[model samples]
Target: MEISCHKIASGKASGPALVSKEPISFLGTVDPETGEVVDPKHQLFGKNVGGKVLIFPGGKGSTVGSYVIYQLKKRGVAPAAMINIRSEPIVAVGAIISEIPLVDGVSAELLDLEDGTLITVDADSRRVRTEEG
Candidate 1:
């Protein structure tokens, strides 16, 4: 299904979804060099977000987390795109500076989608779709 949402960044990306049920604190939760979720307490621990469409509730923790996201992009390990139920300042700024496609105001149905489902996000168009559609 094609879902309408608010655009937080300007770009288009398609990839398998890496859904995270919890909010992410990028600075400590993700490894910039490898794109792995390093926080053992996180449900997504041990998973690599690289090249996927990272989906989560929103961002949490320090504003420095924004730079971490940028670092991931600079290191070529950032998610292809991102979707948030709500876009907070940190993640919003990160996606903007990193040029990663990002959208928020997504419906809860999106969070229920299984991991690895093909997802296409067109932030420029304020739309998201699943491969099944």
Candidate 2:
């Protein structure tokens, strides 16, 4: 199935998804070096986001989170792409500067996408699709 939405970054990626129902705070919650969610309180804590299509509601916490996302990319440990219900300044800026494929305003629920399922995101065209399609 193909779903079109707003493209926040111009790129494309195909990878397994790591879906989260909660917001992510990259600054203190994510390990820039390891790409692991380190905040124990976060539902995704202890999961490594590396190379996956990381999906979440949106971002929270400091704007410095943008730098953390960049750091992850620099360290070669960032998500292959990102999908959100909506895009905020912090996460949007991070995805832009990091060059991570990012799309928002998706109609499907993160849960419906299924964790670990391969999905393709084409941010340049503002579309996402399940591998089956």
Candidate 3:
């Protein structure tokens, strides 16, 4: 399946998708050094987001969440890319500063995707493509 989205950051990434139902706040919800989801309330808590295409509804919480994303990147623990249903300033700024690909306004295919589906986030073209439709 190929889904179109608005480009929030420009880059390209491909990997297994790590889908999250809840919105994320990088500062407290994710461990910057480990890239693990740490928010107990989140279904994906305890899972590592590193090396995967992190998919979530959107970002919530502090503006510092951007730096946390950058921190994750600097620590080599950030997601390969990020996709969101709505790209808010917090996450969009984070992805941009951290050089993580980000695409937003994509929720349809995301809802149907399996946990570990291999997907490509082509932010340069504002598209997310899956092997299966």
Candidate 4:
């Protein structure tokens, strides 16, 4: 499937998708050292975002979350790309500074995509494409 979106960062990446229905707060929800989703309350708890295309509705919580995203990058454990239904400053800034490929303005139906589906994100082109699982 091909999905058009607004680019939030400039880059291209391909990986398995880690779809999340809820918003993410990078500050407390993810471990910068390991890139694991640490929030037990989150649907992605125990899963690692490293190398995956992290997908979610948007971001929430402290603005410090942006730095956390950068920390993940420094530790070499950040998402290959990200796709959001909406783009908020925190997440958008994080992705930008972290140099992670990010795009938003996607349809909510994207949330229905199965986890681990292979997907490619071309932020420069403002496009996301998925292969049949």
Best by lDDT: 4
Give the Cα lDDT of each candidate.
0.94, 0.90, 0.89, 0.96
Q: What would the TM-scores of all predictions be?
A: 0.97, 0.95, 0.94, 0.98
Q: How high is the lDDT of residue 42 in model 1?
A: 99
Cα RMSD of all models vs. native, in order, equals: 1.1, 1.5, 1.5, 0.6
Clashing pairs in 1: none
lDDT of 3 by residue, 26-133 (tens): 888999889998889888889999988998899999999999999999999899999998889999999999999999888655955787888899998978898742
User: How far out, in Å, is residue 16 in model 4?
Assistant: 0.1
Worst lDDT window (10 residues) for model 3? Answer: 106-115
Q: For candidate 3, give the lDDT.
A: 0.89
Best by TM-score: 4
**Which pairs of residues collide in candidate 4?**
none
Cα error of candidate 2 at position 2, Å: 1.1
Q: Between the candidate structures 1 and 2, which one is better when assessed by lDDT? A: 1
lDDT tens readout by residue for model 1, 1-133: 8989999999999999999889999999999889999999998999998999999999999999999999999999999999999989999999999999999999877888899899999998999999852
Number of clashes in every candidate structure? 0, 0, 0, 0
- Candidate 4 per-residue lDDT over residues 42-120, each given as its tens digit: 9999999999999999999999999999999999999999999998999999999999999999999999999989999
